[model samples]
Target: MMPLSIYFLAPSLDLACFLAKLYICCCIKYVVVLRSYSLCLFVFLLQPVEKLKKMDLSYSEHLIQIPNLCGAINLESINLQGCISLVQIPSCFKNLDKLELLDLSDCENLKDGMENLPLNIRELKLCRTAIEVLPSSVRFLLGLLDLDMSGCNKLKDGIENLPSNLKELRLCGTAIQVVPSSIGCLMGLSHLDLYNCEKLESLPKSIWTLKSLEWLDLSNCPNLIELEDCTSSSLRYLKISGCTGLRSIIALPPSLTCLDANNCTSLEEISSWWTPTVQDYDPQVQHQNNKSEGEIYNFEQCLKLGHDTCINVIEDGARRRILSALDVYLYLYLFLSLRKI
Candidate 1:
């Protein structure tokens, strides 16, 4: 047996054993590298972010206070949305020169102390706050773009003056009977939302002079009986839902693209012998991006007025439903359109 020594088989067995050992060594080295990498990642995650830029403590109802934010020199945005019990921000907040946005929406306990905010602030959202009166210093914020005070039920007529650079203003449910005439100073105002303003009776005559006015929402204003002529070249969307006191729609701007006058049972006529002015629209594609606006109204009373010429409510309703998709709007539009024929 030793003469030939089974040379071929013995050498093959030795080579196989060597290769198995090398494979095991490589796997062990790879596992060690993976463990080191995981340790480094864990350490990075545990590091503190004391130099934070944006601080969002939204929905922190239990959190009663915040530390001095002067240390955060680069802080630009602060959102305290729905912090119901929050009374006020730290007085040192004025040191935030870089702050550009602030939102205190739905903070019921916040009554005042926002008089002197950072001048660079471009947007302020104080919707549903307990603050009944706006600060006089609001006129100094020349960079302000939007101001939302919706659902502030106690705010009656405090908005006598506003930033001239304002582009959007929302005062829904404020219960103000008359709009401030100084609103016309905002030549840049494009969008205005006054939905569910039940106590609003009249509008400023200067409102019609806004050339940049594009969208106006006056839905559910039960006492609004009449609308003045709107000649804004950019005016497009308008809503007048639940205006039971209104009897007519006259002198509407030619730039109108959408109108909602639903449940206006007292509405008798539009434009006095009005015919639907055919507008250029995309019949194939719908405005799926728009919110749930443009509700359908029954214009049977307007038809019974026995005017010599009239606009077909079916054509208007079906077109609106096709665009906005209100609840049960599509079915009603189809039925009414067919019945009209």
Candidate 2:
């Protein structure tokens, strides 16, 4: 049997309300309102929608209200991305115990009801939103794994309370000044992206202790001055491009196979030792691979590095039986190296 669905047209208010009620009796499970020009939508019918599993209102440019969803107990996904006129998520969202994915990216005016989000969510994307701070209640989402808050220029704090089991976190282009020490609690995290965070000044030492962390991007963070020693970590790819204020790269993880430090105009020193100290080295550290069988280290335009410091990077790579590449201005020193960006 064919399932019934309703697409929002330029209907009268009464006609819209009547269709809202009519769909409820048809046991509809999916409600999609793509590019809806209506200023309002009543997908929830001001009542319970027990069988509704997904609601997609993406790119609904004129949408100004998020209909009440208190009784959508079975809803598993809701995509309201690009709803520029929407100001807030209704507090009743906390009642959706089964919801797993919520995409509210590009909601520029959103500012409230963050504390009322459902607990079972696994992936939440709030990219380019106007939220100032994540509410403390976010720590309660034990099942959440992926969170993207990139371009949240108004955000200043609250990342310390993120759930421990989260696997991927992206805070690109934010105004965050510091990464709290509590970040080490995300033991299972594998990907962390903080690219282009111009105001970021420092990262907690605990960031180097994340055993599962493999990919970390800190590109274009001009305010950062130094990268401290790395002790026990599994990071593989590290990017510090365009960090003009950086003065040194103290140390790195043994598992790291890629380092991109292009255009770091002020970098002066980089340690020869892979681990924090020679004594902290473990043979097993080299066994941790990020599905790659090669290495690439870029030092393009780093004219400040001393001759000896440059040699250390090459010698260390040779000792590890991997290729190495360094560029000081137009001169390129390549030893069986492959540049992978």
Top candidate, metric TM-score? 2
Q: For residues 237-277, what per-residue lDDT tens digits would candidate 1 score against the true structure?
A: 77787777776665565445566776766676665321222
Evaluated at residue 83, the lDDT of candidate 2 is 85
Report the alpha-carbon TM-score of model 2 versus the true structure.
Answer: 0.82
Can you give the lDDT of residue 231 in candidate 2?
39
Model 1, TM vs. native: 0.67
Model 1: residues with Cα > 4 Å off, grouped in runs: 1-50, 272-341
Residue pairs clashing in model 2 are: none
Clashes of each: 0, 0
lDDT of candidate 1?
0.63
lDDT (Cα, tens digit) per residue for candidate 2, span 178-244: 9999999999999999999999999889999998898999999999999988736778889999999
